[model samples]
Target: MGGSSLRRLNARLVTVGVLLVLAWGGIGYRLVVVQALEADVYADHGLDQRLQREILAADRGTIFDRDGRELAVTVDSVTFYANPSEIEDPTTVARLLAPLLHQNMLDVLDAISGEGTFAYVARQLERDDADRVIAARLPGIYYFTEPKRVYPMGELTGHVIGFVQADDNQGLEGLEYQYDDSLSGVPGELLVERDPHGRTIPQGEYQVVPAEPGSDLVLTIKTEIQFAAAEALQRAIDRTGAKGGSIVVVDPATGEILAMVNLPTFDPNDRSDADPAAFRNRAVTDVFEPGSTQKVITISAALEAGIADPDTIFEIPTTIERGETVFRDSTTHPSELTVTGIVAHSSNLGTITLGEMLGAKELHRNLYAFGLGQPSGVDFPGEASGLLRPSEEWCAVNCVASTSIGYGVSVTTLQMAMVYATVANDGVWVQPHLVKEIVDGKGTRVAVEPLQRRVIDAATALSMRLMLEEVVSGGTGGYAAVAGYRVGGKTGTTEKYLIDEQRYSEDDVVASFIGMGPIDEPRVVVAVVLDSPRQDDSGGKGAAPVFAEVALAALHQLGVPPDDR
Candidate 1:
């Protein structure tokens, strides 16, 4: 009986020991699978949950005036971001950060209440202000350094230097938009480990690829000249009661835009209430009938064709009937005047007579040669190739008379300026450009070489220059005379064409004067256009004085000595 009891107890003990061994074996196998077989997969999953990738914005390139003055620059600014999913009680967090960020509490709440992991709280805060927000120690809120675009010259260079987007610093208008890619550099990458509360994990998976800076642009714009032109234009607008205006100063020899000013300008630094309409560089973008300022081209073309010399005489009637339109000069002239007198007095019939001799195709060819009816091919964006219809498209009845007298055509201020500039440059039309050179981060410099083409013979250009001198010295452009220099120019006054109504406004006119200085050795060419002048509506009274002021300032700035009287 004792042996049987012992055997049964031993069997029970053996059963319990076997079950314990099996359980231990299963536990050990499971541990091996988790720690060795699939260890890499589980480890990677845990790391991804803590890992963060960030973009390191590249430093935008600097914009410099011809004399190395900074126009546009990038400065250190703060951009605040948040981990919305990690934020506990978004309403409370928003209330704490709202006042510091200068944002409405509700707006802040909406920004932080998102279920997404990332959100922007505010952008582009000054460093001192950003530090104050950091001191608050709010959970889920984070900050990073972003570059802010600043125009130091303010509204003075705003039209030409242009402004950028607030958040990304992307170029939006003017030169900023024109050269965006060259200005925006390559961005870098950042990898870091962060805790769920938006705090960077110390000594955990930090990496960085430093960003490269963008190339810099050196412009041909002279600051002193730009300021003078702007001031003079503003005064013209005030005196003439004109809505707006544009002034362009160029170096005819090099086609360098010395100073380009457009009114209704704005401060690029603070664009809180800026009108988008004012963003256009009107000197390059807007077009108008050049009126008699185009006479320079017409007279130059006639001389180039050898159809009429400056001394050639023509029957200059006060009114000449052509088709239904009786073409007439704005001011009465002698019944018969020399070619020079016709140009000096700006006679419509006299120029039409020359146009008849030159013929339509020859006239069109000459106008095209003088840089009309085509884009000036300036480095500037949106340059209007003044509207010139093909000779075949010209209505046989009135196109010749109207076009010869600066009507039935359109031209940009810059385009017409270059016409006089062409004559000033010895009949050579050099491609216009604002930028002088581009400098890369490596210190390599590339100069912008403008294209040049001969529009007329040097002799013809010289003859036209002398004739234009008469216009300023004794004729219609007398008001454009500079105080100490021998200047030559033409007056232009055209009825303003209303785009919406598709007709010329009876009351408003575009008054313009384009001129060059030191006639024998031309240096500067200035073009002024005043729009919709309520008073002093003629180019002689409205736009010529602007030319005088800008030309004198430019000549003095260039150190061009006054011509011996």
Candidate 2:
């Protein structure tokens, strides 16, 4: 009986021992599958929870004038961010951040309570305000340094500097948009680990790829000259009760633009309340019939082709009849005038006669060589290649007559200025340019060379300067004479064509003056253009005065010795 009972108990014990051994073997097999076969997959999954990859912004470059004055620059700013998941008491956090960020408390609260893990509370905060926020040390709130584009001179160079979009910091207009690639820097990367509490792990795995800052731009603009031109243009607009105006001052020798200004310009820094119309850089963007200014080109062509000289005499009737069209001067002059006298008086009759002699092909070729009907290659955005019909298209007799008087053809103020600049540069046409050099973060500098070509002989250019001097000294552009200096210039007034009426408007005229100084050795070429001035104010009375004011100031600023003195 005892043996039977013992045997039953032993069998039960053996069954329990066998079951335990099987269970242990199954657990060991599972450990090998997880630890060895799937080790890499589990390791990556764990790292995903602890490691964070972030984009680091690179600082944008600075823009400076030729004199090293900062025009556009980058400054450090604070960007406020929040982790919505960790933001407890969103109402309290929003209330504290509202005054510091200049934001609505309700909006801030909504942002912090969003379903997303991260949200922007405020972007580009002022340093003082950011400091205050940092002192507050609100949970789930964080900040990082960001680069903000700032225009220190405000509207002084707004047209050329242009502005950027706040949302993505992308350039939208002007030089900013045209040179975006050089101005925008290469971004970097940041890799770091975090703990369970969402804090950076101390002495843990971290990596960084440093950002490469953008290259700096050096412009050919002279800030002082720019200011003077802007002031003079504004005064002219105010005096004439004109809609708007533009002025361009250039160094004839190198074709470096000293100043380019347009009235009704907007401040690049704060464009939220600016008018869209003010954003246009009229000097390069707007086109108008050059009026009497075109006569300079015609006279230049005639002089260069051996057809005439300063003393070449021609009978200038009061009115010229070409087919059915009648062309008359601003004033009646029935006497004979020399080539110099014709340009000085800005006679439409004489100019049209010269155009007939030159014919359309030769005239068009001369105009093209002078940079008309082409972009100035100014490194600016939205430059207009003014309206110019090919010689073949000038079959109509009216086309030749109208173009001779600057009626049918159109040109930008920059092109007109460059034309005079070529004459001042002894007939060598230098391409107008804005940028002077490019400098990288490592202090490497690369210079920009402007394009150049010969438009006329040096002797012809000298003769043109002498004839232009006659204009300022005694002719229609007398008001353009500067004190203590010998001035050379031409006055222009043209009626604007009405798009709706399909004819030229009698009241709407563009008044302009193109000039150079010290006829012996010209230093600067300036062009002033005003739109829709009072009918009583012709180019001689309106634009010439502005030209004198700006040209005088420019001469003084450039330290040019007065020729009169």
Query: Per-model C-alpha lDDT, please?
Result: 0.89, 0.89
The Cα RMSD in angstroms, rounded to one decimal, for candidate 2 relative to the true structure is: 3.4
Pairs of residues clashing in candidate 1:
none
Weakest ten-residue segment in model 2 by summed lDDT: 326-335
Each candidate structure's TM-score, on Cα atoms with residue i matched to residue i, is 0.89, 0.89
What is the clash count for each candidate, in the order shown? 0, 0
lDDT (10s digit) by residue, model 2, range 396-478: 75777778778778899999999999999999999898899999878899998999999999999999999999998879999
What are the candidates' C-alpha RMSDs?
3.5, 3.4
Colliding pairs, model 2: none
- Estimate, for each residue in 295-345, the C-alpha lDDT of model 1 and write its tens digit: 777777788788889889887766778789888777777898999999888
